[model samples]
Target chain A: MSEINSSKTVSIISRQAPYGSNRAHQSLDIALAAAVFEQAVNYIFMGDGVYQLLGNQNATSIQSKTLVNALETLDLYGIESIFIDSQSLRERNLTPKDLALNASIVSRGEIAKIVRASDSVFNL
Target chain B: MSTLHTVSKAPSFRLLETCLSIIQAGDAVLFIEDGVYHCQQSTELLRNSEVKFYCLREDLIARGLIDRKLDTIETVNTQGFVDLCVQHDGIVNWF
Candidate 1:
């Protein structure tokens, strides 16, 4: 068994679209909680999750809180190290310029490596 | 190695099964998000597993299934959820 350590790394992987649903938001809430607790937290956006980072989101049309607005609060909460899958963005015809917030773009292989390094991972 | 498996969707069972196959005893499986619905179904597969099973209390409440009786499954709140992550050495997400 691996020896337990005082510091923990938690990774939150967002795979749902922004708005029109509560899954992605709830996931962010947990991520924020872990960050506030002073834990090492990382957020990864993959699959349809890349859409959550798209810029200029206005959820008023759908009667939902904009996802980008929620994500903007991450840095303030000490939850840095946000990443998005490059392939996901490419598949959706989106680029980093389309994202409202700044985040590193990573390949699937890189994402796998990040997951391997994390002590705990939450998918939503 | 101690692996913490978190499942949040019923469709994720395929991935969860794959994870369970690789994980031995002494590991834990936590069901959260919409994954809490999986706990409601009683099946031979679940009955046979030695892995520790857990459900998120807040998720169950949100789904209006909090009052339902469950067998062989432990319910945990957000704090307990954080504790679980701390207790396990690794985490696998099945969405």
Candidate 2:
């Protein structure tokens, strides 16, 4: 997959809340897959997607897989370009301490640029 | 790179609000389905000059918002919607 010097940049914008639907999980999988292939991946959490990063998300009671467990493998997969929308966090009254992962808090304007720069974008 | 964002929900859901936050200058937003309701509101995004605003003509007519829509909003038909998509680099749909 890394035969070429330059790989296409892919941006995965996950905007759905965890536990409610499969979108959040699917987006994460896509990001990891892109990273595995040596593609430049940008994982952006916006709108309700930011909720997927909240700490203490235990889904055992709901009989579902814990998202945090999968999130823990992101570093191992080399997908480090994680971004959280600042406006979404402020609107939800949440901060970095409330989340389980370390991500760059970026303004929406900056996010727009990220989407524009990406060779391909997947909005889930 | 300019983007064409499409909002399909009403203002009450805040989808448009979130979408507006990410819009940049030279970008365009198209209101479709229930999103036409946004045209009737007095939201500040409608007054924004940096980005352009467009709404589906059929959706607005279906919702009886023809006379109520803001003059700042440009009404477009299905063909125009496809044209907008082709004119932009990307399209993000806000449900």
Candidate 3:
């Protein structure tokens, strides 16, 4: 990469559920890695992706590490900027009260702004 | 003004059928990712309808179904896929 000196802002949009496939996990890993590399990584949960933040997820029942638990470790990774699509939560009949973590609840316009501000965007 | 419906999931996901419902008669469909599996069972459906069906060639080969007859369905490269998207007026990425 030519601009190796500059740390770019990378945005990841997870539009899938956390439990079904490894897409959610892989997406998270990318964000964590980017953050570790000192990139300004912004996470936006949209559509089915918003389900990732549901409280009290029990992965032990499925014999897997709870993604919700892994999500808790984001703070240790230095990922403090998280945004959730307010409209998506509304469409899913969920409220911010139901979320496992505290994040900025943004509108569609704000979501657009977040994407626009980033140098790169990823989706899973 | 035709729609290019891009499907990334297999029929087992029920996304192919859902994508079909929204596609008009003159629209086209481009199968990518696991959607290439639907191409195996979609030949008959495409031949009888006005809709044109296509799948990514690399994905077909990756799935080890390159020799599959394909019949009325066309196999295209990544560039060809971009051309198809450009030719269409709209695109629907069905999950």
Better of 1 and 2 by DockQ: 2
Q: Please report the candidate that would top TM-score against the real structure.
A: 2
Chain B vs. true chain B: TM-score per candidate: 0.87, 0.95, 0.89
Write out the backbone clash pairs for model 2: none
DockQ measured for candidate 1:
0.21
State the TM-score for model 3. 0.60
lDDT of 1 by residue, A7-46 (tens): 6888888878876578799889889888877889889887
* Per-residue lDDT of candidate 2, residues A3-115 (tens digit): 76679999999999998999999998899989988999999998889999999989999999999779867989999999999988998999999999998999988998898
Best-to-worst lDDT order: 2, 3, 1
> Which regions in candidate 2 have their CA more than 4 angstroms from the true location?
A1-6
lDDT of 1 at A62: 82
lDDT tens digits, residues B1-95, model 1?
56678888773445455345435567788889988887777655466466898999999999887877377889999999999988987878786
lDDT of 3 by residue, A15-82 (tens): 78976888889889999999988999998887789999999999889888899888877889989889
Off by over 4 Å in 3: A1-4, B1-95
Tens-place lDDT per residue, model 3, B1-87, is 566778898777766654554356677888899989877765444564778889999999999878873676799999999999888
* TM-score between model 1 and native: 0.60
